[model samples]
Target: MALCEIVNKIAACGLDCSRCADYENGEIKKLSRRLQGLLKGYERLALIKAKTNPAFEGFKDFQELLNIFAGASCGGCSSQNVKCPIDCHAKTCHKEKKVDFCFQCDEYPCERQFEGKMRERWMERNNRMREIGVERYYEEQSKMPRY
Candidate 1:
């Protein structure tokens, strides 16, 4: 992949923004909408079955969860107009350094922006990108799940 494309698809923290479940029109959104369509009349069936099967009582909760997933939508962190809606420090740091990714900066593993499992994942991804280069990293990350 080209540098421009890679920058657009990948986040400064090494996440593949395009593959994220919350990204606009992403796989999870599409799947959730499809599943919602398939279960259009499931509430009625669930209500009828609830009297007999106690497990069916949780239909509303399940539906709520599905609705949340179905509503997932984000413009991605790379969007110039709304970069990193959450105001991630890493994004600001990268812009200041004029680097497209964390791996490109001199302080590659600054350990300032993330914590716990996220910090670990961030380090691992940036290291991998540094070792293999962004193009190959983008190709590899494209095949992986965001969540």
Candidate 2:
């Protein structure tokens, strides 16, 4: 695929779908799975150490969190496997309007699927995409932390 096509995982709300924790095979899930593997035998160690150290008592909760992260999988905004935690209106709006990104829409900053810091981010990202184009915007965002 072309670089543009490959990184076309940008969401309608200007978020990078690949950077989402729920993204299938994304970095968060991959690292969580690897860490689970590395800590395979740590359960027994935690059990033994829990008798001597109270801090080790939280191992069960830690394991639960790790499992959640490791099991996380979603196919992005456009996919059927969309597991968005929020009540996202951007995706539906995009589909109805047939726009690839919010920046491409007639009403870019409409009140939908964004609030507080996310609203700010949406405006900034869309404006950046408008100024530099989606490909360049994606390149610039690729070098920064998602959150």
Candidate 3:
């Protein structure tokens, strides 16, 4: 695909879908599967450990993490399955305003639902998108390290 096309995969929330761990690839799914297998294998051991140790209580946290990994796959907001509040709001707002991005709206910096550092990050990203344009923004995002 063309660079611009790839960049256009960025979500309305300013997240580069292309940089998402779950975007197009099955890394998260594979990891989740492996973790599930390991957890299954260690279930008995975990049960024993939990009986004598408080730290093993963290097994619940591990299961939560596993759930996150398992649900990490996404195809961006355009996907029919996407149901994020930010994505839905952005899409609706942009469509109503006939603009391509949130930055184009007069309420660009207005508080919709975001708060604190999250709002700051969103503003910064939207400003950067405006400053650099979508294509270049994606290129810059591509150069940044991924989690």
Candidate 4:
């Protein structure tokens, strides 16, 4: 696909939907399914194993992480069924200003934009997008290792 087409997956808040854990065709979904099966198969065995191995004590935590990963898969912000407040707000703001992306706004990195870890990550991404431009930014994001 063209770089612009790939980069167009970027949400208004600067998050690269293509790189998201829940993004279509991403590894997280496959990993989540595998982990679910493993967890189910190992449930009783893990408890027994934990009695002798301290390492097995983290099985509960691993299960929690598995749940998180399972829930991370998304069809991107543009999915009609999903209601993402951040993306919604960003879209509204950009539309009001008649700008294409958040980076195009005059108050690009305003304090109001930084809220939680997700927003913070997007903010950093926005900075990178500004530094490298969309195509290069997409290339760079695509190169990063996914969980």
Candidate 5:
């Protein structure tokens, strides 16, 4: 509710805003709440999974990682650390070479060392936006004024 300065149409994650649930609250809020509950449920499952599944043992430290994402209310990239990937090869390489997104630089798809997880997420968001229509979703979300 604090009229935070949203990017209006773009996320540093390369998302075209209108796709965000926070940006389209009416229809989105229910889903968002559901997702919030799901995330919480996922955390619980992760805890259980961490104990039994060696594959998920990496998630043993899930709490710490989720804490970073918990406060992120789609508050923009620069402002939200949740969007900032930890040890992101893309960001590191970008900084080392002095560039922005990989798409902007010479390397659109660096198979040698690419962020597959992040890339997949980007694709998912993009596809969802395309399906929902950016402005349609935005108008719905805009109803819930930030302040």
Candidate 6:
């Protein structure tokens, strides 16, 4: 099949879909390891640098980094951005009100929680929206076919 055709068939998270491990799972592990090493070294450096570097000043408490890393790495909204009904609902609702993901709406589904496969995607995008914002959500989501 052609590239576009293949890509179209391949599932994606639309918003944070690029965050998935996918074929990059191995790379994620390697990069995680490297980041851990650099972070460890940075931690050691941060101790001394915090007295000088403004950047380190904010991160003076190494416990904060450890606390942040204690949780899971965000994957993506593969279903929220790709699944059938959820994708349809998101697009239709957005177009109806002329906004991006539910985040922009005054009446967002704040009740959403990690439940079904589709919920999993929302969990990721809900978090990603904080980083990328609603415009990117609509932009990426719009590229997707309605069906």
Name the top TM-score candidate: 2
What are the lDDT scores of the predictions, listed in order?
Answer: 0.80, 0.82, 0.67, 0.68, 0.46, 0.46
The TM-score values for the models, in the order shown, are 0.79, 0.86, 0.62, 0.63, 0.29, 0.32
Q: What number of clashing residue pairs does each candidate have, in the order they appear?
A: 0, 0, 0, 2, 5, 1
Question: lDDT per residue, candidate 3, 1-147, as tens digits?
Answer: 464465357666577665565654445566787778767767567778998997787887888778776667666554544534353466456556666567878877666737877777778878999998777777787687754
Q: How would you encode candidate 5's per-residue C-alpha lDDT over 51-143 as one tens digit per residue?
A: 878767665365444443343355333232224333445534645555433444465455544366766765454354446644453454466
Ranking by TM-score: 2, 1, 4, 3, 6, 5
Tens digit of per-residue lDDT, candidate 1, span 5-97: 778778888888777666665677789899999999999999999999999999999989888778876766666533345446676788888
Better of 3 and 4 by TM-score: 4
lDDT by residue (25-134, candidate 6, tens digit) is 22443555566666765666776887777777666454455444343243323223332323335534555565544555665554433367766766566555646754
Better of 4 and 5 by lDDT: 4
Question: Tens digits of per-residue lDDT for model 4 on 51-107?
Answer: 999899898898888877676646555443333434346745666776656787898
- lDDT for each residue of candidate 2 in 1-147, tens digit (9 for 90 to 100): 255563347887777888888888689999989999999989899999999999999999999999998888888886667887766688779889888788888887887657888788778988898899888888888789987
Worst 10 residues of 6 by lDDT: 17-26
Total clashes for model 3: 0
lDDT of 6: 0.46
Name every residue pair that clashes in candidate 2.
none
Which has the better TM-score: candidate 2, or candidate 4?
2
